[model samples]
Target: MQNSSPPKMNATEQAYHGIRNDILTGRLKEGERLTETRLSDDLGLSRTPIREAIGRLILEGFIERQSGYTTRVAHFPEDEAEQVYEIRRLVECYSVQRAARLATEEDIAALRRIHAAMQADTPPRDQAAYQRLTEANEEFHRTIVAAARSPRLTALMTTALDVSMVVRTYSMFSEKDLRRSLNHHAELIDAIEARAPDWAASVMSAHLLAGAARVAARLKTAGSDDGQD
Candidate 1:
């Protein structure tokens, strides 16, 4: 039998995951400056791997290359942030419908496992707990996209997903919002299992729209506060 273990990451991959985890956990805050030398020292890796990791991150929309050969954690303006969700709606809503029709038993099983993980006994009480939930949530969505069996759609969603990570959409959630989101995921699974494309698409549409509205409202509130300041 072939080895079932996952492959160990190489140095560059290590750097990439390290940096991405920091960004996702807010250890590397949005718009925070980065330099290869600093990151090399911080991650205890050499500059070559750090440079390679940064390049990949920039391509994946996790880091932005600014003027003067500098880079920072990616941050979007309000308009672009809104556009991110619009694009997600366009991409993911369709993907979910395709998944409903195309997903195999194994694919559906993976999604259910992710959903069950998210539906832990208690709510996320701290940053670490929330991080686990967020990662699980991301996995749930990515699995659906994978089940859609479209590489082009996956590529299209790459940047949108990264931007959503940067925005930390779940941070804006209330207890009620969290419950509603869990329900949406459950409904999505049911639709996909039933092979109901229309139902799956409808649930995905509502899910994405609700998330977009939350992000937009938060952005508006932040903008208002900034103006006052």
Candidate 2:
């Protein structure tokens, strides 16, 4: 049976997750300044946790601290984004292949729950619902990674799955693209259920490539807009 207990988290850990989610969902935004004082006020917490969280984000490549006095959300540049997708494709292809061999029935069910939430005619309609969908997407991929049972592979993927690239890529997904992505998740689960590692890896590769293309286009559009401005 799966452990039903929630993992314990300190204030700093909680603050880290909260701020990370905001960054991933575009609530924080790329290139937006992050002031400890403003974050403390917005999060209704002390500066200590907020400060700690920012420090961690910097190390994780989600935020950048300029010199010693400035901080901002990490921007998704085309060059860096290409590297992120390339690494994700390599790592996740291996991860999903292993998951096909290792994932339990319960793991499949957990993934299905996330997939169901992403289906057609049921797109997220509010801020909270959108947050749920975004987090569900993250969980679906993380579950596959965990099922791989490779700590090193998981660690590598974590770096590539940085918030800037993830949010910027997901932000450009149109409603049609969103539905197709959900379809891909369903197909991936089917591949895993069939214990076809190659099939599962192929699906994951296509998913990452599509996301990379979306993010690249978004960067190009943003660049054009900036030139106009």
Candidate 3:
């Protein structure tokens, strides 16, 4: 008997996820030219799906088309980063506030479990932890947002996370930064457990803004180093 599990995703979705992951993980390199033929061969798909995937990524702000011929990974614009964080802070704070009001015992417990996983997977150095932590951190946020029960807000927040991963890959975090993030996650979990809506909301806002500031600083430092070299 051929073990018949459900058929996996078709080519277009596979191509989309593969290219998106490469861009998010910095393997594609910001501003590096992308050719459909090359990408199709590399990802082992045909040009049709690869083109469709690139179109989707462009729609998602992960890639850009230029000079009617060239496509490249999108670069992080500092101003755009600031704007994204500002919107994220506002939306996430509101989401967490509602989550605190709505979360049940199960919700709080699940959040704690997600955080525990994050704590356990301490990536050595900041090298690629950004990619590794994406799912865990996303689950942590999604739990709170889902508790709010607002589909519209959840959709918006999902887009925000996608954009954030792009910015995060360009900024390396220090050990102190990682620890601070862990502590903030703990505080958030405590606030949710206590059903402190105001406190949870405030902590979530601070956590996002603080992360944005750190990433922005890292970008600046990287820019200076590049100039020196």
Top TM-score hit: 2
What global local distance difference test value does model 2 have?
Answer: 0.84
Spell out the clash pairs found in candidate 2. none
lDDT of 1 by residue, 68-141 (tens): 88999988577776777788888998999999999999999998898888888237886557867878888888
Q: What are the runs in model 2 whose C-alpha is more than 4 Å off?
A: 1-60, 120-122
Model 3 regions more than 4 Å off = 1-28, 37-56, 124-132, 163-171
Expressed as tens digits, the lDDT of each residue in 18-130 for candidate 2 is: 89878877688789999999988888889999999999988878898887689999877789888888998999999999999999999899989878876633476765576
The better candidate by TM-score, 1 or 3, is 3
Estimate the TM-score of every prediction: 0.74, 0.77, 0.76
Model 3 scores a TM of 0.76
- Looking at candidate 3, the ten consecutive residues that score lowest on lDDT are 163-172
lDDT of 3 by residue, 73-187 (tens): 9887678778877887999999998888888889889988888877776653453455456567777878889988899998988887664454353235566776787788999
Candidate 1 stretches with Cα past 4 Å from truth are 1-62, 163-167
Candidate 3 clash total? 0
